[model samples]
Target: MGKGHTSANGGSRTEGYQYDINEKSILGDEWCSMYSTTAPIKFEKSHFETAMMHLIREPNINSTAILRADILREAVFEIEPNGKPKVKEEKTQDLEVTDPEAKKIGIDDLDVRVAPTNPLLNLHVVIQIVRRIIPRNLYKDAIMNQTCLIMNSSSSKPSTSLVVYTPHIKAEDECPFYIPHVKAVGILFHNNVLSVHYIPFDNVELLRDESQRAVRTAWRLLQTAYKHSMGIMEGYEKRVNHDQVVDKVDFQDCYIAFKKRYSKFLVDNWAESTDPKKHVFEDIAIAAFLFELWKKIYGKDFKEKIQFKDLGCGNGALCYILISEGIRGKGIDARRRKSWSIYPPDVQAALKEQVIVPSLLLRPHPEVRKRIPHLEHNGGLFPVKVAHELIAPATIVYSSEDLLQSPQVNVTEFSPDTFIIGNHSDELTCWIPLLGYPFIVIPCCSHNFSGERVRFNVRKSTLQSSSKSLGNSTYAGLVDHVEYIANRVGWKVEKEMLRIPSTRNAAIIGYENPFLDQFPTQEVYDVIIEDGGPDNWIQNTMALMKRNPRSH
Candidate 1:
């Protein structure tokens, strides 16, 4: 939410709220459209009215609470022309002050007799009361009426339809501006049906197109805007869960405490000047999640005992947090980040710079043969020389014995119970499951055999194909691919949408290592070999390894 420059309730200018409604980029217009999409909820007309009453009164706690708490960052109520209400912003800010003349009304005082006609109009005055992300003069068309009708006219449809609306403000205007008001409607009709309607203002489109094209030098502006809109639309839909948890982990208390401490430390230290809020909070969330997961798996005192290796640990922030919590872990990445140097000496020592090549890919050398005589190996060609600077480690066919030996055939080797953490691990997304250890992967980039971003054809289930589907994006397909690989390797998988600061928050957790016992280990390898021919697993694994000039 942007801060408002003036006070509407005759309070001090600094006391006013900010309206942060910046949807111009999403809608491709110089002026933000008063656009809203509808959702059909299950309820009778009377029931809907009751819900609406509750929603308007305590909207911060309603179904759309997250949007309010996150995106809007505040709850806004319509003020009758003559009536006043005390204002409250969801997040506490330095500029917040009370409007003494405004009398606050409780849910009991709210009149739900009329159906709210336009959400844009309903929240317009209050939105202007604080900050405006859009220009006030730009959408003079959206504010024809000052107040939104509490009750719909006598003939309006009943409880199932839900509409969400907000107005646009101008960049130049510090105060309220009104003119030709236009409204965009979203109708969620019968049987969970939905329709979004936007009024196309001719001049507005021309202004946006011409102005944006002039300023945007890159070709991705339009593509980025399209993706942004798609993401927002997807957010409006109800989330579906594909993996069910066999064992539950509760880390809410740990997360809350850690978040507070971590956030304060970040602000005080301030390593990266450019926007650390989102990244800082997200790393903290991951910390809390990992802590809880470890507690569940190894009992409450499981800290140093459960070792971890964070593959593709960008910035090594998570490694620092985990180590501070008394967990012994090392983070491996191809490239070291600047933020790594900012950590204390002890914390810095835990982060390692090396690309992790799965031991299954490398060929056995004399060192392995001498040290571990019982280690079994199958024949595979070593990496071919390319530009001579880089080396693509060959795929070393392994029996269960090699896994136990912890062979240093490549960059690093894993211990028996070492848990793998692939937090936004791009190329390593699919390899985590094949390593045959308990792991949790939160995939970010979509990549394939050649370490390239490629989309895989999704094999949707019968139910998913027939149902009202939220079509999969490249990211979602990648998540599915990771889950599929986990299943192929005989791992019991569970997925969770982590409570984090970023949009890419889904995690595929391979907690149950089905191949942990001797019989199943060989059985799982046999299935992998049979699935493709004996060499098929190697080919598939190699294709995903990042190729370089050193290994043509």
Candidate 2:
């Protein structure tokens, strides 16, 4: 009989030739399809029946009836070498059999003697039986089947193993696959990759430390530059006044000037008052500071040669200082001559010899002429006596009996290089710069372009703004207004804390460099026109000239 005709149980074949079932071939073709069908079939009987039917139905069946019958029996259960029922202990192990094509296959030995046998074990035995009966190629195709399973595995659980037949395993390039380790949190890339690093949020403190270091370095450079500029000024002063003593510098001059200007208060209160030295010390300190500041900004070349015109120059103390320093200077006021008469003997002699008395007071009223008998014969009276008494020039200039009521002064004749200095120029602060000279006005009243009285309006605006009040007095507002006007006209201005009597401690310093382009001359002219004619001390003198043409 042929190999397909006998049922092989271990080393023994059946005595009667029986047909062997092609169980492997049937299972390879129909296993997946039969499993998917909805029809119910008895697990025990249908396993053998299905295998037999598949073999019989094959058009190319070569096996005889006896061989097919034997194959069908083997499809249901494996047998032992003897015809006796197999013992459970002997049949538990799998049986290894060589097929006709010399390919090795495993079959599970069936144990019919075992009580209450497991169906899953029986099923495993039947599957092995099918493998032994099928062709090698068919068995290879059947073994290549793939399956996927999902389970609720924890992070610590091992991954399920994938069984792949060696010949059926796919290449890495065929379809890429990745296995990821579980993490608390991670970054995923498009390529199924993850990164492991991160940055913290508290790095701003590092940036702040770097910025502070840079600022400190910049401040040090600025201070160094300032000190270097001051040193240059000191060197220049030494060179310029080599013959003069150190006490004769503008700083010392400012001190003497302040004392001379406010001598009345000094003499009357200097000895009797407490803190007599305080005023002198304050003046020296302020002057020293001003000298240093000026030197740092504009070198020492200009201060010694700078020409100054003191408008409303009361007693000409500041002008005297500038002149004594060899600065080309001139002073004007309705009271300059009057102030000279009240000067101590030495100051009065120095003033009479050195300064020119250009314009004199015109006493339009008989009462004023009676007070100074020289006015009727000479078209003007000296200002030394008036400033000595601290008398207001407005009382004389605006007197009703004056030939020209509201008499005005013209300052143009006083030289183009002049910088008009209105030190405590009361009403003249509003009028001095309008005389076509560059000006530094320390104002003393609130008189405006129009003769309207300006009251303290501090609540309306800031003291920095022109409309606001500077202080409780008219003098304070006038100083504020002058500062506002100078800024409006594009003058580079500096406000200094002046060392002078009266708490109105502001001083303005203005310089005009001929090298600089001329200011809007037409605008300045319009301002002069708008201010209703120049009424400065010189302009008022000119008005006196025009009134009595032959007086000079």
Candidate 3:
């Protein structure tokens, strides 16, 4: 080990011989002792090879590579046979090398252009890679480079045991104290025997518990992933399952920028019983997604073209982020949260405390609150006084004309350009799509139009399409139901399983409502009055408002 970094596996890496590697560039522990997997060792080498490569491309799949930000996952690129990268050039950073001659290595440059990083294999298919890793919180955007070598024998049955290797180039001074410089991971596949071989860095005395555990977990992830790839385990896929709706890079950049500006403010000062990190970070991610989504739908001038109204805005963190980012928006909640006071005056102003009453209940035909219907014969009447509308069959229960005329009932209509955000808006979830304005609603706790908590079911057909058997969970059912309502109301709905760190991250978006011209929403009216209408659902919502936090 001459002046560079070397592993305990005896694969000494001298700064002078760093580029001198070739077919002799080994992967596993030359000392033949370190770490290895125990169970699930029996697997075909071919299947294991595919899995090994997949894991190399995405180390974060097993959720053990958490010390860096997308380094081992998104940033790594394959070095093609022609010495060019397979990844887009714009996404890569300048490669690190002390030798200035690396870029201009010619035929006379002593075979320095390839080898170790691209080990030679005469008959097998060889894969060469240059990987990078950046510490998550130690220093922002600081990148460190590594390399991987995969040489697969075409006929696994005829070959001896093959040890695939991906070695890390350790940087002692640059490495975070919380993470190790390297964990030389090796894999052996021969005659139904598969085991991971891990070699800790040579300086075991300098290693910390955190870094050691990180390395241990890394090898475990390899074993688990290999088994899953061989169909020996179940669902060993990527951990953070973000949907491919918006550009991931754009979303991640937005999140990082937003977090840098607001995470401390929200987390340090949070007053809710819930863990601030979860709520704060999740909201930040959602805000990031919204920024990207709006930009996609309305171009770069989305903030100038659209104004948002976030219903059930809870702690108002999302509103704070959007407003701070120069997007004009207001967040309304049934009750004001303690965290709202920490925001600036302008941000605070964007949060309102008000219960929602859809225009359906406010547009009056009669004074139904009195319960004595002066014009009812046998059916389809406003019925008796109840908070949650218990209609006989088909009933639209949220609004009225007499109440608008009355000072007690406050009904506010949105402008044609208004964009509604029903984020965890409970009762407002179902109605957000029905309103003429476009909306993005994330259903949290399931609630009917009457503000009553109800566990809706996923239609038998929809359960199959959902990632989960949504029928088993109330939250998923509500998400599906909200989309259903939007579709019924002549709105072309879209859904994004948001990248936010919350399970209830499914966002149903309806940016284009074809029924905008149909102001009365006669179609919504028909849905409300289905099967016979609520027995007393007509006036139930308004009457029940007296009990909940959303009282008008």
Candidate 4:
């Protein structure tokens, strides 16, 4: 009499007949077929005809099979305590559930709690899978799709855990699809279900060529958004533009000098003069602005005992300005030449005359001349007479080469309150902060452990995800890395948009606050290791400094 019943002779009869049905096959179709030849049929009448006989009989084979099939069906889509289907909704249309409680039920929505947070574990798994899958083109679409799906699931809005995996749609054979930037992936939560919106890959063949590009695009977008939000881009732009101008001027001057020395070579080369004076003038203006910045931050006293070390003291123009201000400064560089001849003879003569005033005057006094012969030859008792007095212990000790790499010098020898200024320290940007001195670094190029060039680490992901290399000599990407590193090391970092000479902008200014307790020496090493492992610049410097503290 049940649903799985039939009569003899194929008659449409139903009373106490039983038949077994395949639950798997039945569920495959939307509608179940009854009395079909595919289903086994059985019947029993005597067992039920006489109630006095007690209808005692053996278990019906057909009935037992039918019961087993029904049990399997129940297991597949068993109702939960809330009276909602427990199975995942595979079809998108099937997701349209009216019950608010049932709406959150979906395939990807199952909550699997993980404890003891480890972010790198997931990334490592993904990376390993990617590396193992040869011919990356084959799985490119899947990987991109997965990225989009995961990114979209992370909702900005508060919601219960619910996931939905959209079925892949058939793609046209000739159509092309490109992945969108990772930063553009938008996540939304509606009715407790997370929705991910991302670009679907059409051609998997381009994966190998496009992988790096896609990652870079994503990172750049993220970085741009962060910089804009933080209002650092405007400042960065000004500094970069100023720096470019300064560089152009120096390049032009060098070119002119070469041409002047070799007229035949210049004619043969047919190189025309490019006037970079305008750029030089602009740089001067930028320098003035920097001076104003220093004044504003430290007041007029900034010119006092405070020593500024131009890490890469090119041309010594800045040093000249500081010297004019009576600041004790020294300029060091790998390349040294006597260009003082460029000054007029009268000026030079005046300097020379003043330098020998003491010697000239003390010549008559044997006692004075013996003590100061150099000065006594020129004049009485005094040496180097000029409009302004020069201060002692150079205000700036900079070099084009790696100053920190030198075995005889340690950073601490500069001064306890020295300001490390990397106007454009190039590769030195990475090691600038490790000196444990107050620093102002303007990043130019990107450099990392593997030595691969990158713009920025746009993703707020793990540090390794952001690791990149130092490209051209002018790129200061390492400075940006140092910014992140300094913060982790507990140095109060500040960024100011300097109105400077180049477009390669953004200056990370850091200071050691006396109020805060000094970070443990070991902690410094820990930070370096944590930030993209160890590198030669960091390891060697630390080792050398440890061995010879006075040499740093």
Model 1 residue 350 lDDT score: 75
Better of 1 and 2 by TM-score: 1
lDDT of 4 by residue, 69-141 (tens): 0000111133457644454322221112122222111223222221111222121000000000001122222
Better of 1 and 4 by TM-score: 1
lDDT for each residue of candidate 3 in 176-286, tens digit (9 for 90 to 100): 333334444445554444544444456643322223454344345445645565663343444334545687657866676788789999999987777898889889988
The alpha-carbon deviation from the true structure for residue 212 of candidate 3, after best TM-score superposition, in angstroms, is 4.1
Q: Best by lDDT, which number?
A: 3
lDDT of 3 at 460: 74
**Model 1, span 244-349: residue lDDT tens:** 3322213444554566556677656656544677777788878988888777778888875679999878777788888887888888766667778878788788
Q: Point out the higher-scoring one by lDDT: 2 or 3.
A: 3
- Superpose all Cα atoms of candidate 2 onto the true structure and report the RMSD in Å to 1 decimal: 44.5
Cα deviation of 282, candidate 3, in Å: 2.0
For model 4, the stretches where C-alpha displacement exceeds 4 angstroms are: 1-279, 282-286, 337-412, 448-456, 459-479, 512-520, 532-535, 538-552
RMSD of each: 14.2, 44.5, 9.8, 26.9
Q: What TM-score does each of the candidates earn?
A: 0.51, 0.34, 0.72, 0.33
Clashes of each: 32, 28, 30, 58
Off by over 4 Å in 3: 1-33, 38-42, 62-125, 131-142, 158-170, 176-180, 198-201, 204-215, 230-241, 364-399, 405-412, 467-471, 531-552
